[model samples]
Target: GPPRGRELEVARLVRQLARERIHNVVFTAADVHYAAAHYYDPTRAQFRDFEPFWEFVAGPIHAGTSAPLPMDNTFGPQVVFSKGAPPGQTLSPLAGLQFFGQLDVDSRSRTLTVQLKDASGQAIYRHTLQARRA
Candidate 1:
């Protein structure tokens, strides 16, 4: 998770981008000991001046797995998908809870695909984004 002040600063930047008509903004993060996908909708945020965007989180490829954490509400993140250890339990890497993410961009079609894969390289979750026309 990010510091609250920094998150707010990012929110302001996103608001500025929205005012400039920017679109198709996406964010990625890792090292939270879990894998999850989040969608941020300005309409649902405490700060409502930004456009919608997607965030993909993945990590702990060889560490203990942790359950998903609560997202800050300033940007209104909705957890669209998540996979991790159960509550009050931390699974070791050998437990098959390890994960990594893959991203593929298709320049011709202006699309991006994201996949969260397990230690054995099998995708457990996938999502595709179609770039918005300028």
Candidate 2:
């Protein structure tokens, strides 16, 4: 996601989803060689009806990890959490800082837990989202 790369397209799609009463949406992605959590709050935006959702960035797996990507403010994105290479580390996929993300869902509780971890599966960050059934 290039900040606001496809602003109009994303906005249009989100609006459609909201119109269908689908509010529990979370956009999970990878390939940016970093990990971060973002929240898109509709209250701060022009489109007031869109439901708030999260966009989770995870992975590169064995590839080198880099710094976190910048957020696009078109959707009023807020950085909830972010983790990247240690201070002074260079940005490269071959930096031996491979990472990955996992999601654990508990249907009974209606909760989704996201974890960002290193090669050893040691979690670097964790977030839990509670879903509201329509």
What would the per-residue lDDT of candidate 2 be over residues 1-134, giving only the tens digit for each residue? 23254676788888889999996799998857777888888876655557899988876765666677565556778888777786555456555567778999999999999997876789988999999889
Worst ten-residue run, lDDT, model 2? 1-10
Candidate 2 local Cα displacement, residue 104, angstroms: 1.0
Q: How far off is residue 35 in model 1, in Å?
A: 0.5
lDDT of 2 at 116: 79
lDDT of 1 by residue, 42-115 (tens): 77788788889998988886789989877777888899999999987898888889889999999999999999
The C-alpha RMSD of each candidate to the native structure, in angstroms, is 2.4, 3.1
TM-score of every model? Answer: 0.90, 0.83
What local lDDT score does residue 91 receive in model 1, on the 0 to 100 scale? 85
